[model samples]
Target: MANNIFEKSITDSLINRVNQLTPTTPNQWGKMNVAQMLAHCNVTYEMTYENKHPKPNAFVKFMLKLFAKSTVVGSKPYKKNGQTAPQFIVKDAKDFGVEKERLVQYLKKTQELGEKHFHNRESHSFGRLTKEEWSAMFHKHLEHHLRQFGV
Candidate 1:
C-alpha cells in the first residue's frame, strides 16, 4: 500500500520534514525562499480547510480537471520546480515560524480526521476525490517541496 497522510507514521515523517526547515535554509531548487515555501505549502491545506481563495469558475475548473487532476492525485511524484497554480504562489515574504506552525497544525488535523473523513471530499479545483486521491495530493505535494529544499 502507498504511504498516506491518514497514517500517523506518514504524518510524523512530514512533520519531521517541516521541522528540518529553518529560516536560513536555502532551496536546492525553485524560486521561493524558505518562508515563501512554507507559505506555499500551507496554501494546499488552506484551500482544503479554508475558503480564503475563490473557487475556480466552471470553465477553469473543467480545465483543471482535465489537465491537472492526474498530476495532483496520481502516485507519480512532481517534477522539480513545476509550475504552481496562481493561488499557490507566494508573492511576498512570509514568516517562517508562522507558516511552519500552521502547516504542522494542518497536517495533524488532517491525520486526526483520517481517511474516512476525506472520502469523497470536494476538492478546491479537481472536484470530489476519494481518500487515496486526497492522501496523494497532500503527501506528494509536501514531499515534493520538502525534497526541493533538500530537507
Candidate 2:
C-alpha cells in the first residue's frame, strides 16, 4: 500500500519535511525558486479547497484523465524540471514563509479529513479517484517538490 495522508504518522513526516525548508534554500532543479515551488505545490490543494482557478472544460478534463492521470496518481515520482500544468505555474515571486505555512495547513486539513472522506472524490481534472489514488497524488507531489529543493 502507498503512504497515505490518512495516517497521522505519514502526515507528520510530510509536515516535518516542509518544516525543514528555509527561505534561502536553492532549487536542485527547475526554474522555480523555493518560495515559488511552495506556491506551485499549493495549487493542487487550492484546486480542491478554493474556487480560484476555473475548472477545465470537458474536453480538456477528458484529455487530462486519459493522459495525465497516471503520471499524477501513480507511484512514479515526477522528473526534475518536469513540465507543470498551466494553473500551477507560479510566475511572480512568493513569500517563502507564507507559502510554506499554507501548504502545511492544507496537509493537516487533508490528513484530518481522512482517506474515507476523499475516497471517490471528483478531482478538478482527473475525475473521481480512489483513496489510494488521492494519497498518491498528494504525497507524490509534495515529496517530489520537497526533494527538488533538497528539503
> Where does candidate 2 stray beyond 4 Å?
none
Residues 1-151, candidate 1: write the lDDT tens digits: 4978999999999999899999999999989999999999899999999989999999999999999999999999999878889889887989899999999999999999999999998999999999999999999999999988898
lDDT of 1 at 11: 98
lDDT of 2 by residue, 1-151 (tens): 5798779999999999889989989988889999999999999999989999999999999999999999999988988888879999998989999999999999999999998899999988899999999999999999999898887
lDDT of each: 0.93, 0.92
With a 3 Å backbone cut-off (N, CA, C), the pairs that clash in candidate 1 are none
Per-model TM against the reference: 0.97, 0.98
RMSD of each: 0.8, 0.7
How many clashing pairs in candidate 1? 0
Evaluated against the true structure, the overall lDDT of model 2 is: 0.92
Name model 1 segments beyond 4 Å from true: none
